[model samples]
Target: MTSASGFLHSLPMRQLRGVGPALAEKLAKLGINTVEDLLFLLPRQYEDRSQITPFGALIPGMTTLAEGEVKLADIALGRRRALLVRLRDHTGGLTLRFYHFRQSQKESYRPGLRVRVFGEVRLGPLGPEMVHPEVEFLSEETASPESGLTATLTPIYPLVDGLTQRRLRELMARALPLLDQTDALVDVLPARSSGGWTLADALRYVHAPPLDSDRRRLLAGEHPAQQRLAFEELVAHQLSLLQRRQRQRQWPAPACTDSAQLSEQFLHQLPFQLTHGQQTVLHEIRHDLQQPTPMLRLVQGDVGSGKTVVAALAACPVLAAGYQVAIMAPTEILAEQHRQRFQSWFEPLGIPVGWLAGKVTGKARQTQLNSIASGECRLVTGTHALFQDSVQFARLGLVIIDEQHRFGVEQRLALTRRGLASGFAPHQLIMTATPIPRTLAMSAYGDLDTSVIQGLPPGRQPIQTVVLPATRRDDLITRIAHHVASGQQVYWVCTLIEDNEQIQAQAAEVAADLLRESLPHLAIGLIHGQLKAADKAAIMAAFASGQIAVLVATTVIEVGVDVPNASLMVIENPERLGLSQLHQLRGRVGRGSAASFCVLLYQTPLSGLGRERLQILRDSQDGFVIAEKDLSLRGPGEVLGTRQTGDISFRMADLLRDQHLLEPARVLAEHLMRDNARLEQALLQRWVAEKDHYATV
Candidate 1:
C-alpha cells in the first residue's frame, strides 16, 4: 500500500524519538496508534499558565502554579490514611496533604528541594492547602519558570488512564510539523471566489495559531477549514445515499398491470373514506407500482394516521398481478394485528391471507408455509420470522416493512434479497409510524422516494394531554375509577416490565383493595413483559373486549395494539420516559371516536432536560414538529439512539446542529462520484480499512 510522505505509516511511541514503553502504552490507550492519529487528537480545553502569581496573591479554589522549596517533609497520619507535608517559599507556606500514599514514595521528598506544583489550592484551618498536587521536580541552578509569574494558560486534553498532558503535548509537537510537509490534498471544495483565505490556509492557520487572538478567530467561524471539514462529511454521506438509491432504481420489478383495479376494489370495500394525506400517499404508491422498474419508497406517517390502509393499497397491485406480497412488522403483536386487519379486508376479495410468527406451530405453521409457497396465499404478514429459511414465497412482488426504523440496513437488504431470489426483485415500500423530522428524513432516507401522511382519519378525536405530579396518586386513581364506572377502558402504562410489575402489582393490589372496600364491581387486570405471550394476548383481549374495566400494563402497548373502547391512558412517572415514547404512549388513546384523555404523572424536582421534554409534548400534538424540537433539545445521537446500526453512524457532524452541512455535502458527494471517480474510490477504500481496524481493536 502507498503511504503519504511525511506522515508516519506507523509510529511506536517508544520509538517516536523520545518516548518510552510506559508512555507508549499510555498514548495507545488514547487511540494514538500512529503519528497521524496523534496529530489529529485535538485538545479538549486550554488553560493559560503564561501568568504566574505570587503566593500572597493566590486565591483559594483557583488553579495556579506555585514554585516553592520543601521546607519540611514528615509522615504525620491524620484521621484516615492521610499524610501531611509543608512547603514554603520566601512569601508564604502551603500544606500539601496526601490521603493514601505508599511510605516509600513519601520518603523520596527531601527538605530544601525545590518543585513546581500545578493544581487547585483551597483554604484550610492553617492557611492554604493542596491535596495530592501535581508536582514537577526543579533544579536549584534553574530559576522556576512559575516563580513570581503574573499570568499563564495551558492546554489540557482528555487523558487516558496512564496518559499525561505533558506527554500529549510532546507527541503533538512531533506530529504537527509533519502535517506542514504533506502537500494539501486536491481540494474537493469549491474555491471562495467571493474573496477569503483558501481551505488549505484555513486548515494550516487553525492547527498552528500564531496568537491567542488567532485561536479565537479560528474557533469563531472566521476560518474556512471548519466549514470545509463539515461540508466534506455531509457530502460523503449524501453521495452514499444517492448512490444506493440509484442502484435500487436499477433493479427490475415484475409488471403488475392490475394494480389500479385491485386498489380501487380494496378502497371501495373500506368502512370509512381515506384521509387527504392517505389519499395523496396512496396516489404516490400507485405511481411507483405502475413504473417498469422496482419501487423503493418510504411512507412516513405519525401514529394512528391510517398508514396501514396505505400499505394495504400498495399491496393490491402485487395481489392483482397474481404475485404474492409480504409485509413485515417489528414484533409478533404488531404482526398479528396486521394479519388480522389485512385478512378481514382481503377475505371478501377471495384473496388468501396467511400469518407466520414464532408462535406458529405444528400443522398450522406447515399449512401457512405451504400456502405461501404454492402461490395460494396472496398476502403474507409476519415478524422477522418471515425471513427464516423455512419461509418461502412463490412469487413475492411487493415487500412492505412496518416500523422501518427498528430494522437495520442489513435486515432490509436481507428481505430484498429474499424477494429477488425468486426471480424478479419486488418493489420495496417502508413504513414508519415514528414521524421523522424533515431534516432527518432528508439525510436518513434521501435514497428512497418519500410519501407523508400528514392527517388522521376522520371522526378520530384529539387526545387531551395533561401533566400531573406523581404526588397526587390518590386523586388520579379516583378520576380513573370514575372513567371506569362510565364503562370506559383505562390503560395504566408502567415503565419497567418486571420491577414495574412488582411495583404495579403492589400499587394495583393496594388500589384494588381500596376500591373493593368502596365499589367491588370494577375488575382490574395486570399485564407486563414477564407474562407469557398467550397470557399477555389474553390480558389484552380482555381489556379490548371490555371484559376488564382497567388494565395496568408496561410500555408494550405503545405500538400496534388498537382498542377503540380504551379512552384513558395514565403514564406513571412520565419523566422516566423519552419524549418520543411518551408521544407513542399517548397515541394508544384517541383511536376511537370517543373523547380520550392522557394523564402524565411525573416525579417531583424534575431534571432540566426531563422537564423540557415533557413541556414540549404538552405544547404540541404534531409528532413531526415534536420530533424536530426533540432533535434540537437532545442531540442527534440521543434522538437516534446511538445503539442503532448501519448508515446512522456519524463521528462529529450532527444531523441537528450541522444540518447546514447536508445539502452542500450531498452535492459535493455526487460531483466527486460522477466527476472524480478515482477520489471517490480512494475515500471508500480508506473508510473500509479504517472501519476494519476499528472493529479489530
Candidate 2:
C-alpha cells in the first residue's frame, strides 16, 4: 500500500517527464489528463519483441523483428534521398531505409553498432529490406532484466493526432514505475473468486503482456485480466441497481389484498382467455401487489403480446381497492389508445377511467384534475403530463408505465413520489413491447422483477414480410392500391436519417402527395411530429375507422397506434431504420386477423448492416430475436435507443459480449452488500464513480 495517496491518480499529465504543452493537448483528446489515465490506458494489441529473427528467416510482407550489426551506413542519392543502413547478421544482410530522418538519427546509426529493428519486411533489390522500421540502439553493456533485454512483447495502442505508439509506450514506461511507489492500482473489490487476478496484477499484465501471453484471448477480451475488470464493472452495476431497489423498498405501498374478485371479473368479461404468458405474469403481479413493499416490476412482451391487457389486469385490483391508478405512455397516441381500452373495460364495471394529455386544456383539463384530486377517477392514463406539477393523484396505489424505455428512471420516480400522500410508494408496473436482450434486462432493469409475455394471443395470424428496391415504387403503389380496393388499410411510413423534423415532415408530405396523385379514389391521411396533437388524433381516428385507406406518417406511429384493420405496412427506406424500429412498425399492421403484409421498400446500394437488418426483420417476427441481433449489430447504445440512464453507462464491460459474468457479478454484489458494506462502497466509488454516492450512505 505504498501508493495510498498515489501521485499517478492525481498528478497532472504535464508533470510527467516528457509531456509538454503540445503533447499534453494531444493526450487530452484521448481523455488522458492524469498519470493514472496513462497507466490505465492499456494496449490494444502487442507485438512479439522477445526474440529477434535472423535476417535470412525474414519473409516478405511479414512484420517481424530482426537484430544485426550495422555493416554500412550512407545517404542514398535518388529522387527521394533516404538514409540506408546495411545490417548483417551471421546468416544474411538486410537494408533499413528511413525516408525522413533527423541529424541525430543519422549520427545514431553508426557502423559496427548492434541494433534491433521492427517493421514489415518486403523483397527489395538487395534481397529484403524494411522501410521506416522502428530502430532501437543496443549498448555494449550486458543485457539486463531491467532494460527489457528479455522482454518479448511491445504494446500497441489506439492513438490520436500527433500521438504515436512509440511515444505512448515511452509514456507508459515512465508511468509504470510510479505505480510501484503509489497505490493507484489497489483492488477495492473483495477477492470473491479464485481464478480472477488482483486489480494491480491485472493492470500490470494487460498494460505490458509477456511474449507467452495469449494474444487471441487478449484480443477477444477473454483474458483473465480483462475478465477481472469486466466482473468488477458488472458488480458495480449490480450494486447500483440493488441500492436503488433498497431505497424504493423503504417506501410502502397500499396493500391491495382484495384484488381477486374484480381482477377475476375483468378477465371473465374479456372475449378471449389470457395466454399462459399473461397468466404467469399476472400471478407474479398479484404476489408483488400483496406485499407491503412497493412493486418495481418490468413487463417486457413482444409487439401484440397482450402487454396492455396484462397492464389492465394489474390495474383492476388497485382500482377495486379504492385507490387510483396512473398509466403513463410515451406518446399521446399511445396514451389515448390505453385510455380508450381502459375506458371500455372499466366503464361497464362502474369504475371511472380518466384521461389527461398536453392537449387537454382550460375547463376540460381542470375537470380532469379535479376528478383525480377528489378520487373520483379510480384509474387515469395519459402522456407525461400525468407527472406535471399541478396534477395530483388521490390515493395513488399503482403506476403503470407503457413503453418504459421512452421514459427515464427520474420520470418513473416522479410518478412514484405522487403516491406519497398515503405514507407509501405506489406499485409500479413498467411495460415495454420492445423486447430487451437478456444482458440489458439484467443490467438496465435488474432492479425490477421482470415478467415477460412470451407468446402472442392465439387468434392472431403471422405477418408476411417482404423486401423490395425503392426503384419499384410504381409496382409497390399498384400493390397498395390493390389492397386498398379490397377494403383493407395500409400504412406508409416515411423516415429521414437526419434529426431535422421539418425535413422529415416534408418527406412524409411528399409520400402523401405521391399516394394522392397515384390513388385518387383512395382517401389518404398524413401525420408527423410537427402536427398539432388534435390533428394527429383526428387522423388516427379516421384511419382506425377505415375512412382513410393509406396513412402516411413519420416514425411517430412507431408505437401504440393500434389500427386492427390496417393490414398492410409499407416502410419507405426501411434500410434507414434499426431492426427494433422496423419490427415495431410491422407490429402496427399485424394486429388484425386479416392476412397482413409488411413491405420493406429500401433504396439500392444498401450497406451491409442495413441489408442484414432488413433481412433479419423479414426472417423473424420475434422481437426478442431481432433485439438480440440489433444489439450485436448496432451495439447497446443504439439498441437501447434513447433510454440510456446513468446506471446503464458502461466504460469497460460489453453487455452483449460479457453477459456470462452478469449472474456471478450479481451474486457477488449481493454477498458484498450483506457481508462487506465498506468494500461494496469502495468498489462502487472506484468503478461507478460519483453515480453511486448515495449507495455509500
Candidate 3:
C-alpha cells in the first residue's frame, strides 16, 4: 500500500534506478516523465492471478489464469499458419495458438512441459482457445498449478510496444518502496478531503488491489480509492481555473460605465421589443462591463432567443465609452451575419462596423485593419482573423465571442493578449446557443459568470415538432408545396454534403435536385460546407429574401442563419444528430409570429438510442433540457466540445459520472485559494504545473 507517496516532489522517471535515457524516453512516450506521473498513470484494468481457473471452468470471453501440461505442440498449417499447443489439466484440455512467434518460443513449448497461461478465452478453430497467451514455465518443484499462481492481482497498464506490462510493474515495485522512505511525496489533500485514505494508500490500493479486492468495482472505477483520486484530480482542475481566474482579474480592464445612452438609443431604434430573457442577460452584461475588472461572462441562449441582439446591445456601452468592441465568430457565415446585423444597428448611428475574415486579403484587409486601429471603426466583427497579430484594435473594450465552443483556449488567450496590447484587458463576453445545464457549467468551469437568456422573443411561436418515417417523405413534399403556396418557405436539412457510400442519408445537392423534381413549380436551392463561402452566403441571402422557396442544405445551416418566413423544416435522418443540434436546426424556424413546424424524417427501424434522442427533441423546447439530456447520452467532453475540455483532461474525474464531486471540488478550490496560500500553490503545481489554460481575459 505504498505505490505513490504523494505530489510533494515530481521525481523524474530518469532518476529512478535502472531507468536510463532510453528507458526514460520510452516511459515519456506513455507520458510518464515523473514518478508522480507514473503513479497517476493508473491501470486501465487488472488481471486476477490469485486463483487459477481450471481448464474445464474457463468460459469464452473471460480473462483468467490457467495451468496445464503441454500435450501436443506443432505448427497448424491452414489458411493462416500458426503454432498451436494443446495443454491438458486434470479436468480438460485448452488450445493456445500464436500467429506471430519466434522459433525459440515454439521449441520451448515442448510436449509434457508444465506451463501456466493467462489470456482471454474465446472460441477458436479448436474450440475455446487463447491467442498469444502469456506463458510461464513451471519447474519440477513448482509443477502444481496453485504453486505458480500470483498472490496479488497483476496490473495491466496502457503501454507502448517496448514497455511491457512486467517491466512497468517492476518500475512500480521500485517506486512504491520509495514512497515509504522519502518525505518528498507528501499528500496534497487535507486529512478530511481524501475520505479515510491518504494519497499514497489510495494509489497503492488502486495500482495493486489484494486477491480479495472487488475486481469488478476496481475495473468499473467505482472503488472508494478510485473515487477519492477522481475527486482530488477534479479539485486540482478547479484549482487551475481558480488560479487563472484570479490572475485574470488582477489585470485592469476598461470600465465602459453605465453610459447606456447609445445602448438605449439602439434598442429604441429597433422595430421589435426585447424579450424579458434578453433584457435580463443584457442587464448582466451591462453590469459586468461597468466593473473595473475584466468581465468573463458566458451568455447562454437558445436559438431564436436573440443572442445577437443582446451582443449588439452589450457592445453599445463600449462604443459609448469611446472604446472599440470586437466580436469573434466561428465561421465566415456567422461572422458576416454578425457584421451585417451590427452594421444595420450601428452604421445608422454613425459607428462604422469593420469586417475581417480569412477571405478579406491584401490592401482591402489592411485598409479595414487601419480603420479599426485608427478608431474610425468603433465596431468590428470577424472570425478568428480578428485575433490575428496584424489586426490591431484602437482602444478595444468589450470582446464578445459568439458560439464560444467553436474556439479553443488558445484563441481565447490570443484575444486576451490582444486586449492587453491596448493597455487594458478587454471586458470579455462569450455567447453560445448550446444552453449548458447548471451542473455542467459549474463542473466545466469555476470561472465565467453565466447569464442564461431563456425564452424566445415575443412573437416567436414554439415550433410544433413531429417525428415521421422516411416513407412519409413524399407526403411531406405535398405539405411543403401547400405551405409554400401559403407564402411560407421550407428548409430540408441533410446530414451529408454529397452522397455517402456508407450512409443512406440524402445529400444536400441530391435532396435539392429531388425537391426541385418533386415540386417543379417551387424554386429550390442547395447549400453545404463544400460550397464557396460567398456562394453559400448568396444562397442563404436568396432564401432569406424568399427567392428560394425551399433551401435544401446540410447542417451548416444549424446556426447564424435566421429567416422568419421559413416556418417548416424537415431534418432528414434526424437520428444521426445530437438532440442539442436538432434543436439548433429547428431554431432557424419559429423566428416569426407564423406557427412553425419541424419534421424529423427519420429512417425506418430506428435504434433505441436514436429513437430516444429524437423523442427528447420532439418533447422539449428548452435548450438547457436538451443539453442536459445530451450531456447524459454523450459525456461532458462531447457535449462541451474538445476545444474547451482540452486543458481539462481529467486523469480520473468525469464531469457527468462524478458530478457529485463538482460542488465539493469548487468549494475546496475556493477554500484552498483563500486559506492555505503555500499549499494551494503546491497543490496547483503538483496537479496543474506548466499546463496553464486561460478561459478568461
Candidate 4:
C-alpha cells in the first residue's frame, strides 16, 4: 500500500549514486544485483569507532580506534619492501606497515601529521604494529580541528576486488533512507513474527546499529534483528520448494497400480526377504505411483539398508503399466551394479534390462540407445549418460535417481523431460544413502515427500572402528598381509591419486606399488578418478571377484561401493573427509555377516575439527547421527555435496543453526499458499532464482 513496498527487490545497485558500470559489475560478483540483495549482505562483524583508545591503553591483539602524530615515515628494505610510518602519542608509540602502497599513497603520510587509525594491534619484531590499517588524515597538529568519530558501530562486510569498505558504506548510507521515506520494507510474514521487530527496523539495526548495541550478540548473529531476517529467509525458501511441489502435480504422470503380479515374481526370485523397513518404504512409493500426478519422493536409508531393492520393487509398478523405467546413478560403477542387479532380477521375469554410460561406446552405445527408443528395453540403468540427447525412452513411466544430491537441477530437468511420452510425465523416486537430518530433509527436500528406511536389516553387526596414527604404517601393512592371507579382501583408501605435498596424502598408485612390494604373493589393484572409466570398472571387477587381494583407491570409491568379503578398510588421512564421507567409506565394509573393522590411518597434527570428525566416526556407526554432526561441522553445502555438485545453495539461513525455524516455516508456507496467492508469488520472487528447474513438468 506504500511507495516503498515493491521497489527494493526491483531497484538495481546502479541506482545508488557513484555506482558506475564497473562498480556494479564488482558488486554483481558478490551476488548483489538488487538493493534488497545488498541489504541482505549483512556484516560478517562490526567494529566500534565512536571513541578513541589511547596508545598507552592499546594492547596487542585488541582492535581499537587510535590517533597520533606521525613520528617518522621511511621505506624499509627487507626480503619484502614495506613503507613503515611510526606514530607517537604522549604515552606510547606504534608503527603502521603497508606492504602495498603507491608513490602518492606513501608520500601522503608525512611526519608531524596526526591521523586516526583503526585495526588490530599485533606485536611486531620492533614493537606493536598494525598492518595495512585504515588511515584517515586528522590534522597537522593536535591543536587543529580533527574529523568527527563514527557515530555508530561500523559494519564490516565481505567484499570483492575494486570494492572498498568506504565505498560500500557510502552507498548504503545513500540508499537506506530512500526506502524508509516510502515504507517499502513490508512484512510478508504475520506482524510480530520477526522477534517483534518490523522488517525495516530489523534491516536498519543490522546495517547500522546504535553505539550502545550489544556487539557480542551482533557479531554472533544472536540479536533479534538478525533472527528476524533469518526467519523470513527460511520461510521464503520453504515456500519456493512447496511451490515446486505444486507444479509437479500440474504435470500428468503415468498412474501405475498394476504392479502386484510383476513385483511378486521379482521378489520371489530373490534369495533374501525384504526387511520390514524396506517393505514400509515400498508401500509409500506404491501409493505415490498410483497417483496420476508425478511422484516426487526422496527415499533415505542407512548404507546397505536394502534401498536399491526397494527401488527395484518401486519400478515394478511402472513397468507393469506398459511403460518403461529408467534408473540413474552418480557414478558408472554404481550404475553398472544397478544394471547387473536389475538384469539378474528382471531378466528372469521376461523384462529386458539395458545399460548406458560413457564407457558403453560405438556400437554398444547405439545398440543400447536403439533398444531404449524402440520400446524393447523396458528397464534401463546408467550414469548421466541417460540425460544425453542421443538417449530416448519409450513411454517412460518412472525415473529413479540414486545419490540424488550429486546431480544438478538442470540434469534433473533434462532426465525428467526425456520421459515426455504421449502427454504424460514420468514419476520420480529419488534415493539417497547419505542420511539426511530431519530438519534438513524437511527443508531441502520439501518439494518431495520423504520415506526413510528406519533401520538396517536384522543381525547386521555394527562396524568396529579404530583410529591409528600414520606412524603405525609398517605395523598396519603387516596386519593387512595377515588379513589378506586368510583369503579376505581389503580396501586401502588413499585420499589422493598422486603425491600432493600440501595435502600430505599418499597416492593410490604409490600405495598400491608399496603394498605389492611388501606382500609379493598378493595381487594388488589401483583405481582413481584419473583412470578411464573402463580401467576403473576393470579394477573394481577384479577386486570384486577376489582376483585382487588389495584394492587401493581414492575417495572415488566413497559412494555405493559394495564388497562383502572386504572386511578391512584402511583410510589414509581420514581426517581430510567429513563425517558423512568417512561413514560412507566405512559402509563399504561391515557389509557382510563377517565382522568388519575401519582403520583411520590419520597423519599426525590433525586439527581439532578433523580430530572431532574422526572421533565421531570411531564412536558411532549411525549414519544419521554422523550426518547431523557433519552438517554442524561442515555446513549443508558440503553435506549434500551440492557445493561442488548442484545449484541448491542457501543465501542466508544455515540449516544447522536455524534448524528450529524449519517446521514453523513449513507450516507458514502452506498457510500462505492457501490463504494468499499474491504473497506466495512475492516470496518466491524475492528468494528463489531457479524456478524453471523446480517446474519439472
In terms of TM-score, which candidate is strongest? Answer: 3
Residue by residue across 1-697, what tens digits does model 4's lDDT show?
Answer: 4323367777888887888899999999988898877777777678888888888887899999888899888899999999999999888888999999987887888888889889999998878799999988874354343356778899999888878898889888887786575546556876656677877887888889999888888777778888877888788888877777888788888888963899889878888878889989988899999989999899999988989989999988888889899999999888988888898899889998899988899988888898999889989999989999888887889889999888876777887888774578899989999999888777767788899998887756688999999999999999999998887889999884234533322466788889999989999888877778888888888899999999988887888888888999999988777789889898999777778889999998888978888888988988999998988888877787762224455655667778888888888888988998777777777666665765663
| Candidate 1 local lDDT, 318-429, one digit each (tens) | 7888788899998776787888889899988888678888888899999999998888887899988888878777888999999877776666776677777786678889
Which stretches in model 3 have alpha-carbon errors above 4 Å?
1-10, 14-17, 70-93, 99-113, 137-143, 181-184, 496-506, 693-697
Query: By TM-score, how accurate is candidate 4?
Result: 0.92
Q: Residue 397, candidate 3: how far off, in angstroms? A: 1.8
Candidate 4 ranges beyond 4 A from true positions: 1-37, 56-58, 71-74, 139-146, 178-182, 496-506, 605-611, 644-651, 689-691
> What lDDT tens digits, residue by residue, belong to model 2 across residues 588-689?
987777999999899998988788788899899999999999988887778776655454866557788888899889998999889887677656655654
Error of 4 at 479 (Å): 3.0
Worst 10 residues of 1 by lDDT: 688-697
Better of 1 and 3 by TM-score: 3
TM-score, every prediction:
0.81, 0.78, 0.93, 0.92
The lDDT of model 4 is: 0.83
Candidate 1 segments exceeding 4 Å error: 1-143, 146-168, 182-184, 193-225, 249-257, 291-294, 361-378, 387-395, 423-425, 496-520, 606-612, 645-649, 679-697
Worst 10 residues of 4 by lDDT: 497-506
Cα misplacement distance, residue 180 of candidate 4 (Å): 4.3
lDDT of 3 by residue, 19-61 (tens): 9998899998887888877877887678888888888898999
Prediction 3 global C-alpha lDDT: 0.83
lDDT of 3 at 352: 79
